[model samples]
Target: MIEYRIDRRSGVATYVQIVQQTKQALRMGLLEPGDKLPAAREVVEATAVNPNTVLKAYRELEREGLVEARRGLGTFVRRSLGAAPADSPLRGELAEWAARARAAGLERDDVAALFAAVLDEHFDSTAKEQENR
Candidate 1:
């Protein structure tokens, strides 16, 4: 079961957090197709969020073709997203790299900026290559 966590201080809307976490779980293979998402009531109980908030998140996911809500049963995952699984070697290597960065005194935001820069550089270059081809 997926547990929703609401960080009130994170500046992100509660519904968005739920949507993003659900997508993350899908990408990580933690939630596979046919998996039942937690009932809105359960998420509300766990996170102290409004039932409507949970519903809104599920609705957003459904809109994205990632999940569907049944009449009585909970929402079911429609498909998985992304190629990277939670246990992938690439994830392990990234974790080790993050640990090394932490040990070298990089703060969370600093590491995030560096990661974003690298992603932009690589993905932008990849896009250019595809355009050339």
Candidate 2:
């Protein structure tokens, strides 16, 4: 069974919560490749969320190459996401931030501030992160 939950009051959008939960499940190895996910209707019933919310989440997952949908069947987990290649821009940026944060003795709060600062300084980062596929 899928171990997922949604919080109505969370700052995150409903669809975003679903995407993150699925990603977390994949990273934790709780949901393996070829595992069939609950139907969109089932997820909506379980979470008491709108069907469109669940559909948007599933669509986002499929777009991310994390899941595949079969007509009249359902969505299933795809192969595990591969490690970032050395030349990937995101990998480089993450590595740089890790080093900077460590050097600056930053904690979670600091990282949060840094993220907010980035968003504040350049609004495009938020859209870019969202658009990243």
Candidate 3:
């Protein structure tokens, strides 16, 4: 069973909320490859959300190659893309600061500020190093 939640209060669309939560669950190994997802109707019933919303989420997941929906069957998790390092482009050290800021209750604009500050610091340090050389 997939364990996830939809934040109705968030500005994000319902489908996007579901897609992100499902992706997080997959990345965290909470929902492993080959695990079957609830049927669209079942999901709607369980979450008290619209069936169309659930279907849209599933379609997005399918596009991302994270899940596959079978005709007359149901959706299933796809195996992880073979052994790429977890620290891909979005997992760099600089990204850690942004993640931390988000976890600390910062909004998108706040995270942007944190990112800009880090970029400025990096550029200043590089310029100083060049001057010293």
Which predicted model would earn the best TM-score?
A: 1
What are the per-residue Cα lDDT tens digits for candidate 2 across 39-119? 988887777889998889999899989999999999999965544544567768988987899799998788888888876
Tell me which of candidates 1 and 2 scores higher on lDDT: 1
lDDT of 3 by residue, 1-133 (tens): 8755777787677887777677666665567789987788877877888899999889978987889998888999986543333555545765786678789999998878777787897766643453353
* Candidate 2 ranges with C-alpha deviation above 4 Å: 82-128, 131-133
Candidate 1 TM-score over all chains jointly:
0.82
Model 1: residue 104 alpha-carbon error in angstroms: 5.0
What's model 3's TM-score? 0.59
Clashing pairs in 2: none
Arranged by TM-score with the best first, the candidates are 1, 2, 3
Q: Candidates 2 and 3: which is better by TM-score?
A: 2
Give residue 62's lDDT in candidate 3 (0 to 100). Answer: 96
Write out the backbone clash pairs for model 3: none
